[model samples]
Target chain A: MAFSLLHGVHVPHRKNTRDMAAVRMDAPKTVVIPMSMHIGAPAKPVVKVGDTVKVGTLIAEAGGFVSAPIHASVSGKVTKITDYLLSNGTTVPAVVIESDGEMTPDETIAPPVVDSRDTLLEAIKRSGVVGLGGAGFPTHVKFSVDLGRIEYLVVNCAECEPYVTSDTRTMLDRVDDMKTALVAMKTHFGIRNIVVGIESNKKAAIKSMMGLMNEVVATGECTFTVKVLPSVYPQGGEKVLIYHTVGRVVPVGKLPIDVGCIAVNCTTLAAIGAYLKTGMPLVEKCVTVDGGCVKEPGNVIVPVGTAMSEVFEFCGGLTEAPDKVIYGGPMMGITVPDTSAPILKNTNAILALSKKETKLPKTTPCIRCGRCLNTCPFGLSPAAIARAYDKRDTVALDKLGVQACMECGCCSFVCPANRPLVQTNKLAKVLLKEEKAKEDAKA
Target chain B: MNTQLKLSVSPHIHSGRSTRRIMLDVLIALLPATAAGAVIFGLRSLLVVAVTVAACVGFEALFSLIAKKPIPVGDLSAAVTGLLLALNLPANIPLWQCVVGSLFAIVVVKGLFGGLGANPVNPAITARVFMLVAFATLTKAAFPTIVDTASSATPLAAEKATSLTDLLLGLHGGAIGETCAAALLLGGVYLLVRRVITWHVPVAFIGTVFLTSFIMEGMDATAALAAILSGGLLIGAIFMATDYVTSPATPWGKIIFGLGASLITFLIRYFGSYPEGVSFAILFMNILTPYISSWTRRRIFGMGGSKA
Candidate 1:
């Protein structure tokens, strides 16, 4: 029960499309792709309005050393270059294009000649493969680190978030691609231990991954194991997963690499394998569209810039008026103002929840039952942190380890008083950062 | 087309466990003790409990109206307070005294302090202390012996004379609810299973008392067992001392709170004039709860050997 100390609530696994194969959606009439999809600096657009571009064409180049390039998802003429609002309420510059009804591929869509490790890393960068687990971190940058120090390569198949089964679909349908990626990392990167951490609730996924690992092991390329974790919310979190699988602790403000582990999502690995085979950049995603308001719920493979409204329409539109359209799973998803937001590289699920699912409970005063403290995966006291944050007590917030909170919403979900513990933890982190910035400026 | 989509932070779902529901669970857990009290003390015990519950609810509602706050009597916290207060009172105590105790617990101790979760002390324990001080004779009055004889002494006062089985079965004289050891243990088990209360407080409190009593009685195990089975130790440990608002939340804090309570209780019972000391010990520890919580704050994960 070492992982038991990593406290989190058991969310309902509403994976309605777990057994359904993903159907490729027809290209929409228009697409609005945001320039800043990844975690680094926003990519700069190279094409202007009225420029004709084909699928896999580079529309936005990397803006910095850490940024990933963006490619066109459909053959189209650029209609407009404007600002678009994301589900998180932030505005980013976007390129809108009108499709010409032809699925034309770019001329640079040939498989790359990977002769060395550096070339493989370069190919990964050129493919614009970011972390498709919803973090959208540049994949090449993660692998660019010193490979000699890494001990384990962890494939995160723990699709622990509820109502999202896109990763599970990847494990079931794309096992060959997953195996190829894992074998490549082992043979090229010299990593010995390759572990695929999947929840036991996904028995099929565990079986598939285990079969792949056995086949790969028979070749004597590398040692592979499947670590079965008890299904819990946020089991896929980078730090939590590394801790559970490798028996390592990623310190605060540190990456998984610091703990001798490089963790990537299962879908990200499959996308990397596809890139290695075909050299096409990340331009489409498997989006799980299911909620109370959805008429026909299933997984749809849509282009990265497809509007949520178009996806919903393709799924037979709403059965009733929706009160919330979240861009991810219910536990950690951001609620969009409407259905017009375009899917990004990291958008895994678009849920149109009805009022029954999104209705907020009436909040009551804190009863000091310590349920939040018990449920926090990071072991931070959200109630105490919230109190310190409300009073603007930076010293107390720092002492209470407010910065350690992962914003997983476990505390808020378990709180009987409905105290908004996650929101307060987020704000408290922001406050701590501001205080640190102030101290740096003074110094 | 509907632009007015409801927006909030993450976690679009809740556990749906409301305060009212939790209070209801607690009331249900206390049923065994309530029934036992009624059977042992006769119908008069039920009247005391009913009157105290009504008075506590009424006072809370009246105070909210006067203070212009939203009435929170629906949460059933007032009912819990009333039941706890009635259980702490002597079976033969008058009903009007129960009303006064309910007023002190609800309006003065709980309502005036910003209501349910804001109170610094356990309302029932504080009110019981207030009543014991105000109506000393009534609180200390004789409990009708099981043999139909007039016995003015509680089992704790006649410690050596009372048999262990009589105390265990609650066949002797004491407060309305605290006398029924079997019923209290049953209720405690229910609360533990329901997870409404943790085991840290009750286990530490009773363990400390038993160990201290054993040492004080020259390592006499029977005397120690008799000491615990008699008096109000079970009721205070399971119900009153574990009150959510008044007790510490952290594991270490709860253990410290329980140890401090038992130490004070041992001193008062061994050296002081009172034969019973559970209520006063709990009240004293409640006053120090916040400090204990701050002192025993848990270490954040991955913060081992790091500077706070």
Candidate 2:
């Protein structure tokens, strides 16, 4: 029973459109592509205003080695080089492109030569691919990990958040692309082990992967296993996923590569596979649309820079006025200021929750029930973290492992007192980092 | 959609388990023991419980009104405190003493320290000890009018405290809720099944008491069994000592708290002049909760050594 601390909470998997095939939406009248989609230096705009661009045209170059490039999602004229406000209260330069009603592909597109590990990394960097699992980290940066020391390729298909099933479609409909990407990574890096991690609720997607596994075995690998974990919320969390699939505990402040594993999302790998074979960069995404205020719930394939208004209308626009419109699942989703905000590269699902659906209970005094300590998959004590943060005790914050908190929101969701626990954990991490910066300056 | 979009934080959905709902579950779990107490001591005990509950709720409302805070009577914690204090009292005690005990439990022990989770001691258990010293007719256990039995200080130390069946069945002399081992065990199972309480504290406390008594009785299993089943050990370990606010939240802390409590309980009952030591032992542990919790703090995951 002591092992229960490492367990996560059970979240309701509200997969309303898991069985529906995705419908490809037509190009909208306009698109707004932002430069700072991933967590690195913002990409620099390469195309000027009034420049004519086609789909897959390079509009922005990588600002640094840690950044990714951006491509035009539709054939259009660059109307304005203005700024777009993000949810973090800061604005970044955005390219407003008005479509020409004809989604034309660039004529100069051609697949890159991929004979070795160096070519694979360069091709991935040019493909404009990032983590599609909502992190938006540059995919090429992850592939450049310790090459020979890597033991397993853990593909995360665990779409554990409720009302989000974009990865399920990737597993069901894009297996060929996934298999090609897996085989390419395995043969180039000589990594024998590959594990596709999925939850038990998606039976159809598991069966499809099983069929694809038989075909991928001939290409190369040591063991190809489908680890079906329990349908727990945050099962796909990077550390939790690595621990569940490879049976290794990534130490505090350490990456998965330190433990001989390279974790990548299933959709990110499939996008890379498509780019490697067809020479087309990432321009479109399959978004899951469903929530309490939605009249019609399904998946739609739309261009990457489309606005939430156009995407919602494509899914038979929201039924009623939404009190909250988030950019992903309800657990860790970013709430946009309004529906007029354009989608980013890592936008997986857009939810418009009604007022009743998002209503939280009145907060009461803490009863010291210990549920928050028990609910965290990492066994971190959110209650104690909140106490230390209130006092601004940086020394105590570091001792409690506040940086290990993944902001999964499990403790906040299960608190009977309705304490804003995870939010406090996030603030505590920032405070500790500031303290370290000040100490370094003094030294 | 609309311009009136609310931009709150993550985790918009909740588990729907409020403090009131948890308190409601606890109140429901205490039903079987209340019924057995009524059957053993007659309807007069029920009247005492009702008066005590009403007084507790009234006093809580009064205190909150005076303090100009949002009244927490809606959380039902006051009702729980009253019911617990009443059951620990003698069934035939005067109704005015019931009111006095309710005041001590709510306004003095609980509300004065700040309501709900702020008290350093278990309010009901502490109030019971206060009454035991302040009142004269506190130890004489009440029996049904039909049974011609002699009342004693407690079933633990009486000359006529024979017949294990009478002790288990609540036909002996004891507190209103403590006599019937069978009824209290049923209620304990209910709380465990509903997950209102964990098993660490109750199991450790009861197991320690049983083991110590077994060794003291020269390895006689029957005497040890009778030792635990008598007195108020079951009610104290399961219901009174397991209060969330005063008890330790970590697993190891809870076990240590329980073991320390059993050690003191056995010392007093074995050597001291009192026949019952459960309430006093719990009060002592409650005072040491902060130190115990800090000493037994759980290690975070991925922090160097063993698995958390």
The ten-residue window of minimal lDDT in model 2 chain B covers B144-153
Model 2, runs deviating above 4 Å: A1-5, B151-153, B160-162, B306-308
DockQ of 2: 0.63
> Candidate 1 chain A: minimum summed lDDT over ten consecutive residues — where?
A1-10
Show pairs that collide, candidate 1.
none
Which tens-of-lDDT digit does each residue in A53-121 have in candidate 2?
999999999999889999999998999988877677778888888999799998888988899999988
Cα lDDT over the full model 1: 0.86
User: How does each model score on TM-score?
Assistant: 0.95, 0.96
In TM-score terms, candidate 2 sits at: 0.96
lDDT of 1 by residue, A193-254 (tens): 88888998998989999898898897685778899999988899888888888878888887
